[model samples]
Target chain A: MKLIPYLVYLLLIAMHEVIWRDVTAIHGVTINLAAFLVLAVALYKSELTVVWFGFFAGLILAAGMPDRLGWHALALSAVAFTAFHVRERINLKSPFAKFLLMLGGLFLHNVLVVLINQSGGFLYLVWHSALTGAVYTSILTLLFFAFKDGYVTVRKIRDIF
Target chain B: MTWISRLFSRHSRNLHLVAILLLSAVLIYGNNDLNRYVNRTTLFFSWPFSQVRCSIEELSGVNAENQRLQQSLVEASLRLTELDEIRRENRRLRSILEFEPEPGYSLLPARVVKVVGDKIPVSAVVINRGQEDSVLVNQTVINQEGLVGRISEVWPGGAEVQLLTHMANRVAVRVAESQEMGVVKYIASRGMILENFPIQGNIRQGDLILSSGLGGVYPARLVVGTVASVEKPEEEAFCKVLLTPAVSFSSLQEVFILRPD
Candidate 1:
């Protein structure tokens, strides 16, 4: 059962890497599906599991990117760990809270990656790409969460009827 | 000792976080070697997926063919005028001397495999050709329409191209008609902006922009774009000129890497 979830996560990461290029991009900001996945996992899993999963996911992403090698791994791990701790204190069961968490996580990830790589034009990247990416990723996370969990509430209402 | 054991039990998460951070530091320290290995593995894994994407793109091309044909028609018209000028110049040079026009550049065709940061204003695309195909860093990339970008990173089987519109990218360009030189830089919210042209320079809307060959990276006279709008601020020493890229980046599928001889 544990193996199944891990395989699913791996599959999601692989699919994200392949299909993300095709996603509709607005001003070059697309939904960060990988970041969303990390946040989702953190909400449900233990701190240790989330950290390892994030690290591995980041490692996989760094493989395709041309930037510094461990930047993504480090960024993702840090974001996941932060998200896990935040989840313990917050009401992440709510869609709004999840969206907020994802927004912060994605922004942090982008900042870490940019800073680690020492990419120039920091202001332009932050204002144009990072913020837009955070908003877009947050919207995507909300939709995904609703799709995955909203059905349960709908089914319960149907049973009541 | 009991208290120490209790602290470990209660704060194990903190320990794990520290351990991961240390691991991350180690990885960063050995980043160069690890980057090569990771990039190789990524290329190996993503190769099949790239092929699949290519196939899907081909299938979708049927619907896009009409649009491409229309674009080709426009490009053909532009090419005709450019060819006529070249022919006149060649004839004039031939009359003056027994001269053989040097073949300036050769084109290596490559397929775009992956696009990165498309949603972000800072963007790049990965092409199928790499060092094996002699695709080197700083080589100019172009489609039939016009300039696409420049190759930034090259591996064995793949390469990454930093698009001309990327924030960090700057190209030296000149107005074709006026011969006024300027540096084209990508500005956020705004597209490509050509700056540092003299305020008195006669740059106008629809003026063609070409690479000035001032920089060693891109060759001379490659069509970069046209001046979409020009702003002559009264207080500033330079004119702020906005450019509309000749090549449509959103629809780019195939491009040629120019190998200058």
Candidate 2:
């Protein structure tokens, strides 16, 4: 319930959007850091916190494009609400289950973004851009899950070295 | 903290959802200035890191360009050396503009393809012209400056000249001022000395020595060298005269064979 941590998370989202987005992109496919963070908050935080954070994160993502501000905020909030409910209904005791939740949430957010921007036909973008981006984000989600589940550790890596 | 817990309670969830929806609707239909202000605030917070990323990329590009410039510098240096050689050849050719052979003989231009001796101011040379070009043995060879030597042995496509630096090579000469005749010969240690001139011959340094036409091989009045020093040694019969050869044999490039008309 501390307000300062959420503020710090929002700052991280803004930093990723402004500085790391282009640098981390792979052959024109970019990581959806904003959606991933929103889904993460939905997984662990209260419903109200996730929803507001999702809205603010979308605003940060669309900072350069003012015309799509409202649509992006609405789309991201909808994804966060759905992810929060899915987490509640589904048994997420397993890291794989939480990873599935993150992947599904990110894919949903990407599709809505493509739809809101009218980037192209839904089926065409679904495989090429949206699904590829979701997969890219999901890899990061799996790494985060591994760290949280203690499957990987810095000490273990050093021991190998 | 109590109010925060109450806000996350099940009942307040619906109110928070409605509040998020209303905020979205207001922003979507609201004036453009509101959205722009929010965007501006976000970008202002991220501006410093964006500048740092740009600087890093520019530094990498400069590193690649530095490698390219090093390659270009090496290429330019080789080109400059080639151009300097050509410039020296150009100056040599310009001085050859006034060159003419003797009245009754025609000059055949030939390049010195190789020198045949180990000594500096080489003792012999091979010219590009040979028997195929009407070149034969014992033909006098001269450059625009003065005498070089004579063709010694001829091949089909080339001929070698016995240069005046050869110890056996001799020229019958006379001082231009006194017309006092002498014989010029090469000595490895003493170098191009006038061996057979009279002790009292009117010869001195700066006097021009020319071929006297006494030896049937070389023509009359063809300059061989200049008297560089004159010493009437008490023990010697002839004046001990040292001459600086007109043609620098070491740097010989082009010459003319005096083929009889």
RMSD of 2: 3.8
**DockQ agreement of candidate 1 with the native complex:** 0.24
- How do all models score by TM-score? 0.46, 0.83
> How many clashing pairs in candidate 1?
5
Model 2 is docked with a DockQ of 0.57
The lDDT of model 2 is: 0.87
Candidate 2 residue pairs in backbone clash: none
Candidate 1 TM-score versus the reference? 0.46
lDDT of 2 by residue, B57-88 (tens): 89988998998898899999999999999999
C-alpha local distance difference test of each model: 0.79, 0.87
Off by over 4 Å in 2: A3-11, A116-124, B1-11, B57-84, B114-119, B166-168, B186-191
